[model samples]
Target: MGWSLSLLPPPEPELLDAVFLSAGRALHLANAFENKCQYVLRIANLASAFDEDPALTLDEAIAAAPSDKMLGQTLHLLVDRFQTPVPEEAVGLLNKARAARNFIAHEGASLGSSYIWVARADTLIRHAVALRAAVQALSLGDCIVSRWVSEIEEPNVPAPRSWDDDYPPMVDTWVFGHFNGLLEG
Candidate 1:
């Protein structure tokens, strides 16, 4: 499809800044987009899971998460419920995008790089472009997620506040800073 400015909401300043930081600092050019999009997918799945099984909790979702791309697929499946259709091509694009991002973050090299043989970065970038288009198709209003979070009755999964207190404050400064940017209002 042709690039259409009319189809997208104006980029939010903070969102743009986060995306830039993802590229410049995180060195994951598609990091912000992937993270935000993943959350969007999660919101959708939660809605569906709740609709089908109201008792379903985040732990249930995590439990159901497949070790494969199903973890990612679960998120995208959420959009399908809102009658917002994403092309298979776009889904493929996002896969490569995240894969490339994983490589850069973990291995610091693309598939063709001598370091480790994996998928090509070019293939990943192509998917990134397609994912951008899909994300643009989602209105900001659609992007907003409001869900009920309750105290865990089970002594399982980590607590929400643990993010702030569990780790050595100094050691997690960089991690918290990166994610905190993504969580900013």
Candidate 2:
């Protein structure tokens, strides 16, 4: 909001460099928070596995992860678990945070000559803030029950309903890093 792309004068190099620096720091913090979340999930899942096989050690239980990218799948599992009280908005927010971090870190992304950096930094900073709070607030110790997972195996929907149907029809929301007709205000 502090800068506008359509303005005649492009932002100074100093400003761009500063935003870039902040972006890098935000990426690092967000990555660390994600690692912590993943570690917690690994232990939570190991607890579940141990419930079924008493002979299993934590190491043996953790070895059961079938894929290298466990955090993405584990977050989905935690969010979908009906017995846990994961916030409904948590899934989307976490997804946006991961996407923001990946785009900034992996796409050889750079601050554009205009206000694009403002938009990118805004997204990165907001998402990083959310991740930090989530990590601090997460309590995996209270959410390691396996009985609910086994008991609720069937889809008991009364009627076919899309998940998006629950959302409001429209709202003022900005998707970071995605620019169509909109520009940061």
lDDT of 2 at 90: 59
- Against the true structure, candidate 1 reaches a TM-score of 0.32
RMSD of each: 15.8, 12.2
Instruction: Write one digit per residue (lDDT tens) for candidate 2, span 1-185.
Output: 55444444433444344445444544554465456556555555666777779898767887874443455665676565334675656555566545544554543134334254344545444443443333222212112222123233333633223312321111111112222222234
lDDT by residue for model 1 over 89-163, one digit each (tens)? 555555654554454454332222321122233443443333333332221211222111111123364345543
- Per-candidate Cα lDDT values, in order, are 0.40, 0.43
Give candidate 2 misplaced runs (Cα > 4 Å): 1-11, 107-109, 112-185
Q: Against the true structure, what is each candidate's TM-score?
A: 0.32, 0.47
Q: Model 1 off-target regions past 4 Å? A: 1-30, 53-84, 109-185
